[model samples]
Target: MVLTAPSPKIRRSATKVALVVGSVLNLINQGAAILGPADISWVHVALNFFVPFCVSSYSAARN
Candidate 1:
């Protein structure tokens, strides 16, 4: 099947989901770097948010 971009509304909803889920995950997975003396990996942080966003968007688009 051909893939297509999700609509703006779906994208917005996905983004919200990603923000909440990703933040919680980051807090759990990278709390030390976030709250203590450690170097934060920007790539990992971005992926944490991005993965959820993509999952949400894909699910919405599929239905």
Candidate 2:
């Protein structure tokens, strides 16, 4: 009998999906810019840092 592990390609695909979803969320946040104050743009910039930290931590905890 033999056992096999998941391949690197599968891991890379999952990472790509996460990045795409994160980018889409960022775009949605940016698209809301016109409705808020001048500083609202800062929120989108902040998410660049915030989102990855949050997602990484959450994923780490799940493992």
> Residue 16 error for model 2, in Å?
5.4
Q: Give the range of the ten consecutive residues with the poorest summed lDDT in model 2.
A: 1-10
lDDT of 1: 0.87
Name model 2 segments beyond 4 Å from true: 1-18, 32-40
The lDDT values for all models are 0.87, 0.54
* Residue 21's lDDT in candidate 1: 96
> What TM-score goes with each of the models?
0.88, 0.36
Poorest lDDT segment (10 consecutive residues) of candidate 1: 1-10
Q: Pick the candidate with the highest lDDT.
A: 1
lDDT of 2 by residue, 1-63 (tens): 011113454445445655776667666766566455534567665665456645654554445
**lDDT tens digits, residues 1-63, model 1?**
025445787889999999999999899888999889998988998999999999988888877
State, as a TM-score between 0 and 1, how close model 1 is to the true structure: 0.88
